[model samples]
Target: MKQKQMKGVCLLIAGILFLLLFFSFSGIEKTKLLDTDGRNFEKAEVTNVISGNLSNSGSGKQTVELKLLSGDHKGKIIQATSSQSYLFGAKCKKGMKVIAIINESKGELLASVYSVNRGPMVWLMAAVFVAIVVAVGGRKGISSILSLVFTMLCIFFIFLPMIYKGISPILAAVLVVAFTTVVTMCMVDGITKKSVAAMLGTIIGVVFSGAFALIFGQVTSITGYNVSDIENLVYVGEMTDIKIGELLFAGILIASLGAVMDVGMSIASTLNELKEQNPQMMLKELFQSGMNVGRDMMGTMTNTLILAFTGGSINTLVFIFAYNYEYQQVINMYSVGIEIMQGLSSSLGVIMAVPVTSWIAAFLYSKNQK
Candidate 1:
């Protein structure tokens, strides 16, 4: 009971620290080009939306009365004119939330309706997810949620900031992965030998996966510029000293980290349980048991990675198939090749994680017995 209380206290302290760090990093200015002279964006609630006749462009004009929810003009009621295009514009309605841009440069407090405010909806969905996880998973669910929040914090705060500050993208990703793995494993399994073994295995598997992705990407001529919005990223890279070229394998390493950690944790946990059940179980027997468990996990985990990547790029595949492209042509396409690389590299990580985890678990558990 005392141990549990201490663990809870530690988690509470960590959560507070994480929140402070999140807000501090989130507020840091990221853009070097934007020079706004007293211009700000604010959230507003639409009290009334008056519609005008449709224009020749098949769009309507609206006079929206908004109550400011944020910014220096909070609680101020203002009227804003908005043109709503039939095909693309967001039509505001009564009581609907919207984002407003405030321009003070003209010495007039003018609020322009930008778009519908979707932030609340996103937060609502996240709340539902957390409630369900906590309800079903109980204490373990809480641990999982904490780990998830910490992982996101690491990505958003540590990884992104480091990359933006001119650190190597690959090195930043590696550090984030290592940090996430250690925190996640410790949260789930406490400070046990199983957690240590799992952490080691996860780190090894993720590193190998990154190495494979880098080597194969070079061999196949699949540069990181194959994805959408890469040109814009290249432009940003010019402004910032970011090496956009190394982002591909860095992406692969981060994407595969979850599956690798899963495999490692599973193998280590199974070995620990087996050792606890039969204290006299030989090291060889424990190792074989872990292998058996890992083999079963490997098949499904590999398929999961492949299907996940395929699902994300299903539209690209459909387009290629619709064009009746030859297999050679389709495989040679940069987009398709990159997807294949991601799937295969991630699967390799999951596959390698099994044995790496099993061996470590076996050795550690055996030593614990002695």
Candidate 2:
């Protein structure tokens, strides 16, 4: 009866997730967008650029009034402005073709210049992922989904904000990684020997990644602060309070945390299940069995981690290509090369943690048996 009830609950959740994905992919609002092709409005011409003093703090902004020369809103003029204090610090000028988001109300047009086009496809893809998880994993799927959300929040709030406050990035990241390791393991596996073993292994792996990042960062002259956003950030705010180097260091550690946790828990659970299957095995034999499972997991987990980071940074490769940088020049480039090294180093940490943690967990758990 309990099994039947659990199956029912899983089916209900899967149904709801499927419905959400279906509705999102149906494009119920695609017709509402003003421009579908994401093309620039060449017929729109900015006729005026006026400077106005915004708070008399000696800082002002420039506004441009644009007139549409063609299309459905011909001869209609709209005003667009840029704040001087904005991070981008962009200034508007005349004769610039700009794409805008438009609002239509009761046959009247209200065009506002924001993003060029809508991104319904991205949301649809996320929905599909959610549906697949729910359909396959059931209640455990829900826990995994919540774990992902918690990870994102920790990175954005606890990790990034504290790093920006001039905290030691490596220290802050280690703390965050430790916290997340415990949280995710406890949530997924509950508070048990397996969870503890996974947590310990994850912590050790994170430390390794952080230490390697610091050493490489110093020796290679890679501060990880030379990215484009950091350049814009310097002009926009007082970065004297922020240790960008530390933030980068922390980012490297935190980046490894997710993969490390995955490997640790996978080994722990696999070993635990192996014990259940082979209750007659001695502790030493069980430890060996766990190490064998971990070895298999290490290969795939490292590949997954490295490939994920590689795919995420393909744009950096594209940028190097556009610049006509030679292979040696690209490899020697501080930021790109640093990330590549960090990704490889982190994967190595994950690989080492798996067997070590699995051996520890299997030894302890098997010895505890009657």
Candidate 3:
């Protein structure tokens, strides 16, 4: 117990140090994407609604009286027009907390409802999620949460910064994947052979996933430039050293990361348990057992990856059918090709990870037992 605590402290310190380094030198502080010089965001509450002209349809505009709860205009009353839109906008109601965009020009205040204040609700949901995980999983749940946080931090801080700093986005992503695999496995099961095997298998699986995505892109002539929002991304690329082209493969690896890690860790952990339960189990027997378990997981996990990608493209799929497009045109579309490549390549990663993890676990466990 003492050793475990000490190791945890060390890992925590290391993570903190890594974050400090990234924050200090990654140039994230210098990257300003928005022009917020004259505009300020403040919390406000809708005290009165005078929207006799408001339309029930998701369009038109409504006049809302807001009571500023924060910022320089605290406790001030302001009237703002809230535009109701299909994709964006807030339906202002009495006592509704909202974000107000305040723009000052010529000693005048021009305020509008920027968005609904969803911050508190988001935090509330997160707290509930944390409580449930802790209640159900106990120590393991705590470890899972820690690993989750660490993974997100690595992605946002390390992976994003590297790409922004002119590094090859795909290469930086792979490095981040490798780093996170080691850290996450260690968090879950310490430095045991099981975690080691999982980490190795996961790294290899992620690489294969990304490689397959690149291959698919090449064959289909679907490069990162073909992705939606290329205009904005290209604009950012011109400002920074960002690699806009390799983001597709980088995204594929990141997307497949969870499923591949799941396969790798599950097989490795199962094999470890089997070897522990029966020390006399031969290497071949252990390998076969791992393969049997992996086969069962393969179908569901592959389906999961495919379904996830399919779900993300649901809008695109709806548009294709809505327009009554032919199957030929649909299959040949770049959007469809990107979705297919992401799903298949990532699923392939999960499938291949099974056997690789199984074999690695079997070999290490058998050898360790001997």
lDDT of 3 by residue, 1-370 (tens): 5658856875787688677757765656456778777799899999998883656675677799999999888999999978867755588889999998899888799988888899999999999999999999998899899889988988888888888878898988888888788888888788777988999989998889998998888888999999999999999988888999989889998999999999999999999899889989988998999899999999999999999999999999899879999989999998999999999999999888988888888888888565
Q: How high is the lDDT of residue 269 in model 2?
A: 83
What's the true lDDT of residue 168 in model 2?
68
Please provide, for model 1 over 249-284, each residue's C-alpha lDDT reduced to its tens digit, 9 standing for 90 to 100.
789999999999999998999998998899998788
Please, what is the TM-score per model?
A: 0.87, 0.66, 0.94
Better of 2 and 3 by TM-score: 3
Lowest lDDT sum, 10 consecutive residues, model 3, at 21-30
Best by TM-score: 3
Runs of candidate 3 exceeding 4 Å displacement: 1-6, 9-13, 20-24, 27-34, 368-370
> Pairing residues by index, what is the TM-score of model 3?
0.94
Q: Which ten residues in a row have the lowest lDDT in candidate 2?
A: 25-34
Off by over 4 Å in 1: 1-31, 52-63, 81-89, 109-111, 368-370
Record all residue pairs in model 3 with backbone atoms less than 3 Å apart, i.e. clashing.
none
Q: Candidate 3 lDDT (Cα, whole model)?
A: 0.88
RMSD to true structure for each model, in Å: 3.6, 12.6, 2.0
